[model samples]
Target: MNRYNLSKSTKTALFFLSLLPLQWGLMWWFNLHPDDLELYYSPFFEAISTLQLYSLAWLPFSIGDVFYLFLVIWLAVLIYRFIKFKRNRLNRFISFLGFCALFYTLFNVFWGFNYYRRPLNQQLQLSSDYSTEALVEFTCELIEVANASHLSIVENDTSAVNFNFSKSEMQNLVFEAYQEPSNFPNKLNYPTENIKSSLLSLPLSYAGFSGYLNPFTKEAQFNSLMPQYKWPTTMAHEVSHQLGFAKENEANFIAALVCINSKHKYLRYAGLTFALKYSLNDIYKRDPELFKVMLADVNEGIIKNYKTSRQFWEKYRGPSEVIMKQIYGNFLKANNQPKGIETYSYVTALLVNYHNTYQLF
Candidate 1:
């Protein structure tokens, strides 16, 4: 008779592997019951995230970036070990699977589950569908507001509006904006202040990401190297993610709302123009002639600001950016956003419908 015993590593790996099914089952349940997620899980997330913010917010630099750097290095070492060593190959592969299972579990528990929350449109009581005429009306109003905001910041109609505040100042402004009583129906409670200029700004800019929220650390990381005109809204967007609006379009809509309602003129400009840019793109898709007509009415300074942003991105346009975007798009699809990266533009529907009732200007 021959006796075989499992290694401790194999046992540990099996334990983690056992968790995968439970995690998947819970995710499915949450997906089917989004209102429960919003009512229960969202509040839980807020409570835990507030604690995370308290822990990590005071640091001057991003601990989340460092965590990612170390994670990549660890993965590389694991891969090299797996490839080079022939001994205990089964154990090694199983351990890797265990690590992946653990990571997936932690991600969902900490932040990914928020992806299953009720849609922002429904929460705000805004319609998701709108006619072309309604879009044109909302967009025209947006253009007028954007032009007024641009003129308020700059002397002439031909020059781009400049952001006079530093990154820290911008973060502070966002904090103040969220604290406003009328800005959000529920108090957003942004005092912990975890927003940071990313240490990976150069690489992030190359990857075509404006900002991201770190699920593990609850820090909002914005690419510092991007054009200044993009700063306020980008910061607001990431802050929205930290506040548990996990979907990109929801974050965009929330950010725009926060900024437009801000007392700061610069933030208001950032918000209005940010909304205008998306509205214009939607119009172009639906009716190009109407798009051209509406765009021509926009102030020259706002046009120059748009051109400046385009030229900034144009400098980094390449195959790698496309690949990065495609990967992110697929990731979004896996996380309940079926339209993938197109989900970002879905903010237009929310904006248009919200404006119908609230009047954005």
Candidate 2:
């Protein structure tokens, strides 16, 4: 047989082109295909369920996010060498990546054309014309409705559902601080070295990116410096992603609705808190003073929490975020969202639209 010689460019090109089916399957087909995504993942998740792990942590997303920064750095050096020494293999590889990137961008744009309405009709996410005090009052009232009546709570899903809920017992959970040493679902803690990362040094991540459920470890990481008060909402949002809610808008709506109905006070507030944040603009239009009073009620702890998170990101932020955004914007467009990163804030629209079609739970 003749020596098989394939350039890196050709191999890379082939790999991404093969992934086109995955792109189509996840974006266009799943929504229309009647729970088709779940059908594809049943056996896979069953296997993952056996692992039994939980995490309040994740790999440092800054320099340590999938070793992406190192990969990019290496790519840069490789490109420089190729230009300086005329290496055909490196040139081919770069060419392949460039092609893949271009294709990814176009794929999002094309698919978004058919799916724009998903975002357009989501109005509940647009805040209410209520003050902060009113927000707190309304949110608390909803939680009480869930609590006093014990509306309906089943251990909802048997497999890892990851949707955030207030502690099953409300009063007991309030005073009890969340202990970091709490065991995983089945109690697996070997104590990998934990390091504190600077949030300020980093950049704003893709909103739901923190939701990744590591296929290998079978763990979903949660990192929200926003406050324990804010934790329930973000936690649920991320967990929804872990549960395989791929689309950001769907995850946002599900997270909030789930929390609102949770038994625990904090979890209930967590969902309502997030909803309030998003709905602030609408509230301001109706009553600005109410918003100010609501702002005053915000405990100092919440402010400090934001500070810690900001400082952490400031530690490792640079060009990575913008570059990644540009690349991923294309990917989002390539997938289902035509607006790219802008699709996250649009989740409220999804929430509003869903509520309109279905009676609010």
Candidate 3:
């Protein structure tokens, strides 16, 4: 009882519960208008984008992350052994996770606070003055323009970076494609009012995040922890969130388009190849024959690229990552993302749907 006395988790949750009403009240008091959707991650993202400190950043830290997970578990197990199997350490773990949840809650409140009271931007003007159909059309046109800028719009770089691939060649092709436009960050900038930096880390630092447009900082934070092959896409993805594409799916979609057009070859592959993979997956699920038809359109070099990517990831797979993915999947769902972690991959749907309609709004 003494060990669990002053349960930190309980205390923190209580604090957040106490703050919820206050935050909500303030949002209403300030007349902060929500976006068309409940989420407006742009403000929060702007708060923590001070990642320029890390240049030349991409790294495959997945293996290191696996080792770290083992270290945590090993320490926990040793503590339990020493404590004669008492569960006190379990409570401590919960406390840490709880603290993270609390911070996210406050961070979200801060975002809501700013968004609700934000000065009307051109985006707001577009949202109100244009019809949904009109807005959708404009958005689609922007996407096409973004995509067309990259030669990978119809092709992923297969020959430039030679890798003999296996079953997942398309994946590699996607990555190699993005290398072009990503060489230079897009010259374009989205409508933004303010930028701030924040310190938001997940429980035990599973992933780190920075707010880009919040009351905290101005530029977007970039995470270099992901695989080197996947960095440019993520850079663009985070930037998309900074640009007011709140939903993960929408952000993924925008990031893919933006990177493919980048002057960097890697960035080009990242966008098209990833989009192609998802499109193929969805198409196969809906109609195997159509999926077959689409697959037929892909060239052999593209096939080789996908296979190489699969092989690369296969070499890096570890049990620790599987467990982490399951937990992370749930975490995303709890964070206003209904499809959980799978939502990130659904950007393909938007791409496929876009192609079907020659006449965008």
Candidate 4:
């Protein structure tokens, strides 16, 4: 009996050990052939994600969040056992490696390969480069549209626009926003909507994330505690991930596109202002003086809304948040986003160039 158990353990460890090189080779091959990756892997992911949504979307809460909670607990137990038991240390360590190998394989099969697919701009045939002058012009246009949207919602220009709907209602609106097929240049088929407010909202806020998609379950989880004004775009961003946009910047662009094109006024406002915020930040980086001048032209109400969001995040700012962000940034860097967390702001380039052809408002 001991010999049989030992043989099974050794075979399991060998299988996992072999998977490491095989997974690496697949990733390398996909990275080199993005066109093939897009043609093959992306469609496969969409089908898999659709099935995941079909299976999980009926639940009222985030199953993905629960899965993560249990995952942490399970890992903690494993570590504790390894530390407490000096015997069978090699076997324990091998088991841990096997766990990691399985997770990596599942992650890549589910969503990681999307990172190696063709760039969204190339797929959409939008220009990838723009001059500083073009950026300024687009930013000015966004400011005008955002100001109009804000005024349409509130009586006074100085008063911030408020969402009367609760978070649950907003989630429904996000679903409705994506239902229209004509809203996007490409066919963004979103069937079986599975967005949910994360049970980890408070912890997620402390970790400095607005929302994220669970690769394993294909659930879109947003921070429920975030300011409602930002919810439309943030929710849309996660849904974009479910649509197989793995890059943060591309998801941002798609989210903005969805919101801006929606018939609902609030969604339109959220999308336009979201794009404007990124564009303004980009301007501040390129020419601070120009940004300051442009800022004055935006409505006071819109600026107040931006301040509210900043204050919410500021309340949770800490060393732990910094560390969390650094870790996530490194994860992004490893996944083909060279700019890491900063890759999000690259959405500005896409927004500006997209507007050149699409007419953002």
The lDDT for every candidate, in the order shown, is 0.86, 0.44, 0.46, 0.87
Query: Which window of 10 residues has the lowest lDDT sum in candidate 1?
Result: 1-10
Candidate 2 stretches with Cα past 4 Å from truth are 1-38, 41-66, 89-91, 94-219, 224-228, 283-331, 339-361
Q: Where does the lowest 10-residue lDDT sum fall in candidate 3?
A: 192-201
Alpha-carbon runs more than 4 Å astray in model 3: 1-17, 20-33, 36-102, 109-229, 242-246, 344-346, 353-361
lDDT of 2 at 344: 50
Better candidate number, 2 or 3, judged by TM-score:
3
Compose the digit string of candidate 2's lDDT tens values, residues 155-219: 32221112243322321232121222221122222222222122322233423133233333333
Q: Over the stretch 41-83, how does candidate 4's per-residue lDDT look in tens digits?
A: 8779888998998899899999989999999999899889889
Q: Which portions of model 1 miss their true places by more than 4 Å?
A: 1-4
TM-score of 2: 0.51
lDDT of 3 by residue, 254-293 (tens): 6666655644555565556656666566556656876676
Measured by lDDT, the strongest candidate is 4
**Better candidate number, 3 or 4, judged by TM-score:** 4
**Can you give the TM-score per candidate against the true fold?**
0.96, 0.51, 0.52, 0.96
Across residues 270-328, which tens digit of lDDT does each residue of candidate 1 receive? 99999999899999999999999998999988988888888888888888789999999
In the predicted model 4, the residue pairs found to clash are none
lDDT of 2: 0.44
Q: Return the TM-score for candidate 1, rounded to 2 decimals.
A: 0.96
Query: Order of candidates by lDDT, top first?
Result: 4, 1, 3, 2
Kindly report the root-mean-square deviation of model 2 from the true structure over all alpha carbons: 10.9
